[model samples]
Target: MQDSDSLRGFLFDNMPIRGQIVTLTSSYQEVLKRHEYPSNIACLLGEFLAAASLLGATLKQSARIILQARGSGALKTVMAECASDNRVRGIARGDFKVCATQTGFKDLFVDAVLAITIEPLQGQRYQGIVPLEGDNLSQCLMGYFAQSEQLPTSIKLAASTQESAGILVQQLPNHAPLEQSTTDWQTINLLIKTLRAKEQLHLTHNDQLYLLFKEHHVRLFDAKDMRFQCHCSRHRTARALISLGEPEIREIYLQQELIDMQCEFCGALYSFKKPFIDALLRDQNKALR
Candidate 1:
């Protein structure tokens, strides 16, 4: 049986190629439970979550990676975040009724742009943006790597309400002859193309890889657990409110006498009374001085 909520990295023993496979079951369900998304939107969000996990595995340091897309169509925005620790969270905002009827990526996200951001624990943050020019998420991500990283990468993604799964294969720089490297990469790409969405969602990592690369010497590492953990807290929420400035805070307080903040990813709610807001503002003022 396929492992649920886990990611595994594998390598081709004979070539400078590496791959990662990720499956999201419980984590995907958790995101769905937090919001009432339509079937199509839910599936798209699942793909984003799975993609984030695969990309997160490639990080060489402690960091967080976010995949976000904004558009003018039925699907207004979708974002997913994954940390080096394998924690994941995602959200989607849009016209659900209209999104439900839209299936193609282009139709669902007209004039959309996808952004990939990497934030390390102690380093500069980087982001890469690409216009949504492909038929699906996998193609768009492949375009990102081709344009930004200059690496030959192929990605396959599949998602349903029940689960989400993705596979990413990338060719690393090798000292081998160019012809040999290109041949090896092309061979692997052809094999990966045989993978179907139903197979990705249903097959175990070992079974899937072996089925695709049984002829090649493939080494798959131990599975790492993936989870749905929102990085939201009262402190972070308070910081965000402070960024809104005192004037905006006071106006909101005047209308409700209390300020309420809810995390879009986890739906956790935090409320602040006038006194707490006053203290926070005082602290901000002191810091400015």
Candidate 2:
């Protein structure tokens, strides 16, 4: 597909290395439209969305990859999540005025902790946390890999007003001994580092990859589309209400004739009236029998 919002995976012909490049246009804009975020926070959320899509490409199950950062700085919390089906969404909550003045990672997120969570569809979940010590998100992610994954990984993330994009290159475990003189991870990383934000946001995915790895024996695969989707629905909301139980639901309904629930990710509202709540409770009770 020639769509701008797509993720492409590639690998070297000879080396034990793999990479993914993703560009977000509509998906990024969808997230921004849900909230009135400042330019800096919007850009940061875009970068996180791209990073999540890139990282989510490595998943083997119908799981999810969540990238989050929380701190006591201008940007209080940022979350980006991508499902195994390539559905992506993101949100940011923070001081917009403070974020407007910040330009650096540390400046925007002081005393921050970056956490990456991998939650499978039907298995154990995993999470890795690292201090936000780098100048940029890419560097912090590389540090996470170094400490938690013990892998040679490089990431270049960028975000603009109209689009967001990122590229990830990782050196896989070798299956056989290689000559010491062969090209190393550092060399490949240098090549990936040359990507610029303007190019990622403007250039086509194929063109961007060609510009970065044209010299290397790169094999590009078909692109996968990334979409902005929220998993929230009436059924899920009913389940949540059921978990709250009858008394809590009654109390909430008493405050207002209709209980309104707004989805943080999609801005969709779900309303529950007394009749609906009673029906839901009855259904939940029947299921418990």
Following a full C-alpha superposition, what root-mean-square deviation does model 1 have from the true structure?
1.1
- Residue-level lDDT of model 1, residues 1-289, one tens digit each, is 4589999999999999999999999999999998889888899999999999999998889999999999998788999999999999999998899898887788999899999999999999999998988989998999988889667899999999999999999999989999999999999999998999999999999999999999999999999999999999998999898999899888888799878899999999999889998998999899889
The reply for model 1, stretches above 4 Å from the true place, is: none
Candidate 1 at residue 287, lDDT?
A: 88
Candidate 2: misplaced stretches above 4 Å?
1-3, 176-182, 239-251, 278-289
Which structure among the candidates has the greatest lDDT?
Answer: 1
lDDT of 2: 0.87
Quote model 1's TM-score: 0.97
Q: Which model scores highest in TM-score?
A: 1
Structural RMSD, model 2 = 2.6
